[model samples]
Target: MTDLVVPAVINLDVPGPVISRHLYGHFAEHLGRCVYGGLYVGEDSDLPNAGGIRLDVVEALRALDVPNLRWPGGCFADEYHWMDGVGPRDRRPVMVNTHWGGVEESNHFGTHEFMALCELLGAEPYISGNVGSGTVREMSDWVEYLTRDGDSPMVRLRRANGREEPWRVKFWGLGNEAWGCGGHMRAEQYAAEARRFGTYCRDHGGNRLYRVAAGANGDDYAWTETLMKQLGDLGCAHRPAPFMQALSFHHYTVPGSWEDKGDATVFDTDDHYRTMVAAARVDELLTGHSNVMDCYDPGRNVGLVLDEWGTWWNVEPGTNPGFLYQQNTLRDALVAALHFDVFHRHADRLVMANIAQTVNVLQAVILTDPDTGALVLTPTYHVFEMNKGHQDAASLRVDLPAGLPSREVGRASLTTVSLSASRRDGRVLVSLSNLDAAEAVDVELDLRGGAVADVRARVLTAGRLQDHNTPAAPDVVAPRPHEVSATGSGLRVPLPAHSFVTVEGRLA
Candidate 1:
């Protein structure tokens, strides 16, 4: 062992912030096969489906206990027209999806179909409204159509489309990326539009809406500053206006520059180390935005929502460039664990977060093959399953001892080991990751303030960092039982190179 490596300590009795289950939220956009072929395979196909929505995908997401599903667009939300997708499927309008591959879109998976998918998964529906080219009336009418009742004009329109009852939608987004694809609007321009559009999205028939303003892009603090100053700040200290409850921003982990992101399955130890360096920027990004928010709204009344996040690599070869299909690797799993740890610590300010796309897209948990209808769970999926205990649990503080193992890349130096812990229902869960590419490291955990018993551990890793799953070999990078040894005052845990481990036990 190197002299720089040292032990760590965790105070389980001193529980910190409560991690929001909504932090484990997901996003499904209308680009490429994400909607048509990825989530919906039609009722006529041999695959199991209900009302043209695939059951296999629903069943998989249910296992994750998904909190919410954001739908209908990334950039596609700006140009989407809600009325064109309701009523009869055969009678719905067909339009071109100019943003993604310029492909023609059949308005088959509309509002009702999306609400049905949410029902099947037991997840909340977070619908992002059209703002770039849509009007105030269109946004207001869509809200009424989904939530209003008592024979209102929009309710009657919804009834003619065959839904007798209204759905209770809690989360609603005003727009997406107004600085770019949503529109070329300045920060001030988007804020004024958000204020006007949010005024008319009324709550009706007991359905309350949580209006989230589309916030900054990446590390654009000026954008965040503009929104905080202009919208909903009626000035009486901590209270923001009712129309705007939360604000959202986006960040993605790209291994290389945007012009040329490296391939998913082709990489080396150096690449793996460099990727961890890129992933560590998430902590700085969240802190930068949260600091700016604190200066304006000191009471933390307005919640920060990271609605779009995850890794983005180049599309697989021979695939459409806009489809965003990439293979998931062991490195991807570590990136997910690293991000969640930062999110757990920032729970006080950050209320919700959603990974980019759930199926057949960038950093997807489930990928459906084009040739065969077989579904493969990626390494990223196993990370979600292992860390599910952290959802809504009270986050525990984990800290490295002095002189802990550290590795330097560029101007950044990161600890070789990353750890996050939480307590819920008389049990404590600890998730640890080793970022060293070629060597195993031992972690000594000094457990304090609680009597623990029956500790169990599981690990997810592969022979190579780039190893991923396919239909032919599904269990290559899956989780299996790991070993944990007892120490005089605590426990000694050993983790392999490029691996993720989880330890769980009940409090006595």
Candidate 2:
């Protein structure tokens, strides 16, 4: 057998950007049961609920301190007409969600319901407007209805609909996938449309909206360059151009193409390794996109918003194909950890990232059974819970040892280990992920500016790569206490195979 490799050393130091808590955000689309059964069970249902939303899910999300929630659509947003969702629920219009499932939307869970949910979860509401199928007036009026406090036609309608106080909505997307589902518009065309629509998405009362342009999908560098260049030109001429607080980018980690996204829970070690490799590609995407953004806006005034991201696989068998629901397994937990690490490392450029999605949808953190009223937190959820301490913490510079081994599955390859570190509340927290399917890693930590006073760790791992929590066994992959010991000027810790670990220590 090959001799065990020397422990990898990581040197941690102070002085870095604070990881934005918004990076821990979530996405809720009107796809599958995500909005309906997943989040809303109706007020009259037998299941316990707050207003029309399920209380259990609310409490779980509240515990996560979910920073922000992007709503209404993936493709559904551009097709959505804000007017259809307001007013009396009984009188609301019903429309077909042709983009997601072919099911009819009751319109009961409209603007008010969404804002109410955001209020309940203590999360900022990020609304995506309709540019493909909606006019500028409609988008502007919708913003007015939600944020306006003074007398206005939209405010009057809001009051007539029973809401006396306006809701504070700060983040707004100009459109979703304008190059594709949103409308087959060219980058130049979409940029012009965004400018026109953003001109009317005015700040009302105390609410100042951060407008995000419809950005590139994956590594479509040209899309980012074109939009940024055009918008940059407009800014130079107009002084302060409309909207443009951020430019949105959507990337999902699928082993294969969209036509065959592979299975969620049935993958072997090879497939799992490939998935990890794909997830690591987010770093490349962010770097390329950021480089393009730098060329136009070298001052970095604008941020990058990863509005929609996460694993997308073939739907659970027998489920509606269009719903886009899939199981979350140990593999997903690693994928999440990988992305979170990347997001934290680049917190300076990233404003927010909404995992796609929250419940009963693609790589959801939580899953629910409508018939049995059962709820389960996936392995991905545990990763989020353990890493919550990193939110808003100062991201520390970590010097990882070079020459780490790279494991390969066919053409795909990934470093055996991934990590990120932060300092908060007089303590240093380090997150580590071991992507190897076999071989636990021995890691050494070198604390530069401070010494470790006390250390504690939490780890999420399972017996099998495919292990996941079903309703019958919800704690199958939950986090458990991990042991760490001081060694010389650092600490030594063992990271189990295919695991996500977070270690926290009081600094001296």
- Number of the predicted model whose lDDT against the real structure is largest: 1
Q: Tell me the tens digit of each residue's lDDT in model 1 across 1-508.
A: 3233347888979999899999999999998678878889877878899998989989988999999999887899999999999988899999988899898889899999999999999999999999998999999999999998789899999999999999999899999989989998999999999999889999987898899999998899999989888644533465677778889999998879898888799988778877888887888989999998887788888889999988899999999998888899999999999989889989999999999889998989999987899899999999998999999999999877564577887677876788889999999998889888887887877889986689999999999999999999988999999998877766777888889999898987
Alpha-carbon local distance difference test for all models: 0.89, 0.88
Quote the lDDT for 481 in model 2: 96
Evaluated against the true structure, the overall lDDT of model 2 is 0.88
Off by over 4 Å in 1: 1-5, 231-236
lDDT (10s digit) by residue, model 2, range 75-134: 999889989988878999999998886889998899999998999999999999999999
Top TM-score prediction, candidate number: 1
| C-alpha lDDT (0 to 100) for residue 22 of candidate 2 | 93
Tell me the lDDT of model 1 at 369: 89
